[model samples]
Target chain A: LAKTTQPISMDSYEGQEVNITCSHNNIATNDYITWYQQFPSQGPRFIIQGYKTKVTNEVASLFIPADRKSSTLSLPRVSLSDTAVYYCLVGDGTHNTNAGKSTFGDGTTLTVKP
Target chain B: EAGVAQSPRYKIIEKRQSVAFWCNPISGHATLYWYQQILGQGPKLLIQFQNNGVVDDSQLPKDRFSAERLKGVDSTLKIQPAKLEDSAVYLCASSLDSRLAGRTGELFFGEGSRLTVL
Candidate 1:
């Protein structure tokens, strides 16, 4: 599995844009970058996923550089409720398969304050 | 659709005692997993199952921990003679298909089962 590097924590004010970047230099060719947000006492929820370039959805946007060595998760107009730990995982997302799977890192905890 | 389900939200047991945790994945998901999360750390995969077959269990401590997903549906994780270090949240997650060997979406996780070994 490819290892990932990201910030341990980040602080943001309401209405501001927040971007969390993760570096996975050894990422596999078939690996996809995915981000999940986890609130206190709850399981992580999928936010967005991308193989390359950029992908956006109702909740967030993902930017993958040309090298695929790193990626960023962008959240717009953040609110206090957005406070949670965000995990950046790189994998093919094939559940039963083996080799170069997803490894969960200590996520970047974002604190969205009032 | 129903989400993954886990039970006995919390557990407290004495050292050397045994305990078990249960999980029910979303309908139609063929893959299931068990992870251990110590406070302040990201979850670590303890085992993985493709239906009723074991996919990977390299991280599980064989002497103490065991898990089974019978009939490829609900699953159970058990630890015999729990230790102090076993005091962590046991998490259950389900995914639609296999990754490298199989084929889909990110895993859906259930609220974890917190365990405290006294």
Candidate 2:
């Protein structure tokens, strides 16, 4: 599993776009970047995933560079409901479905102010 | 569709006592995971099950923690001789069989069982 580093906390206002970047210097060739959002008292939920370049979903957008060394999760028009911790995971199922066993760091706590 | 279900959403016990949590994954899901989330930290994976078999449990504290997925659909995680540091939320998550999907699948999590070891 590739290790990821992200900010401890970030703040933004409602209706603004919030971008959280994660650094993974030792990413693997088969690794795919995935983002998950966790609310208070709730489990983390999938936000978006990308192998390279960019991938957008109804909830968020994931931008990955060609090197795949890092990835950014962009939440457009954020709301107070979006205040939660976000996790960046880099792995795939190539090695015995280990992706399902990927490690999670102390995620970046995003606070969306009204 | 019903999501993953966990029982005894909360448990409290003194140190050295035992506690157990039960979970039922979504129907047809083949992969199950148990994670421990301490306050102010990310959830750490303790074990993963592929159907009725164990796939990974290197992170589990074998001396104290144990988990089983008997029918490959529901699971139970037990902790004996609990310590104060074991106070945290025990989360159960499930996903489709990635081997059949040919790609990593998203995890569906339950509400979680919060354990408070005094």
Candidate 3:
């Protein structure tokens, strides 16, 4: 189990880029960093995931440093619809499935103001 | 492709009452999961099932909360004598594989069932 720490909340105007970073000091060798976005009253949607370096998708980009202790989620040209709670998770993806659970933290609430 | 489906998008009951939530996973998905999310918080995994068999349930409050994924496809989560703390959105997700030996794909989630315990 890896505990992730991220900012509690952030405020930004529309058309701005928002970047949220997470820290996992004890990330395991087999861990994978993943991000999720949750809109109001809806289940979370996967944003991006990466093992190391950078991974980009249509919605967001995930950046992982070489140490694997920190990761960042960059949302380009965020809009009002992008205002949601974002979660950062680090997990030993191949660990004991019986004991390994994807525990979500408080999450960073990104509020895109108009 | 059809996404995961859940029934009773909203549920309201008094404390000590019983409630149940139903979920239908994506076709051919072998793994199913249940999660609980409080207001303004991230979703928390309560249980995971692999082909009708429970794989992990460490976070589930077995005394009051129970879930079953029968036939390895659809699932049901029940709360007996629901508590105030049980007031949250119950989410269901399905994945192709989660055994750690195969390629683990992303989870497809349902709209979720919101429970309110008065």
Model 1 per-residue lDDT tens digits across residues A1-114? 678899999999999999999999888776778898888888888888898999999999999999999999999999999999999888754332133566889999999989
DockQ of 2: 0.58
Model 3 interface RMSD, one decimal: 2.9
TM-score of 3: 0.94
Badly placed stretches (over 4 Å) of model 1 are: A94-99, B99-103
Q: What is the lDDT of candidate 1?
A: 0.88
Tens digit of lDDT per residue, candidate 3, span B15-41?
999999999998988888899998877
The per-candidate TM-score of the B chain, in the order shown, comes to 0.95, 0.96, 0.96
Every candidate's TM-score, chain A alone: 0.93, 0.91, 0.91
lDDT of 2: 0.87
The candidates, ranked best first by lDDT, are 1, 2, 3
List TM-scores for all candidates, in order: 0.95, 0.94, 0.94
Each candidate's fnat, in order? 0.71, 0.62, 0.46
Candidate 2 lDDT over residue span B1-118, tens digit each = 9999998899999999999999999999998999999999988989889999998899999999999998889999999989999999999999888556447668888989999988
Backbone clash count for every predicted candidate, in the order shown: 7, 0, 0
- The lDDT for every candidate, in the order shown, is 0.88, 0.87, 0.84
Residues A1-114, candidate 2: write the lDDT tens digits.
557899999999999999999998877666777888899888888788788999998999999989988999999999999999999887752223233335789999999998
- Return the top candidate by DockQ: 1
Q: Supply DockQ values for each candidate.
A: 0.65, 0.58, 0.51
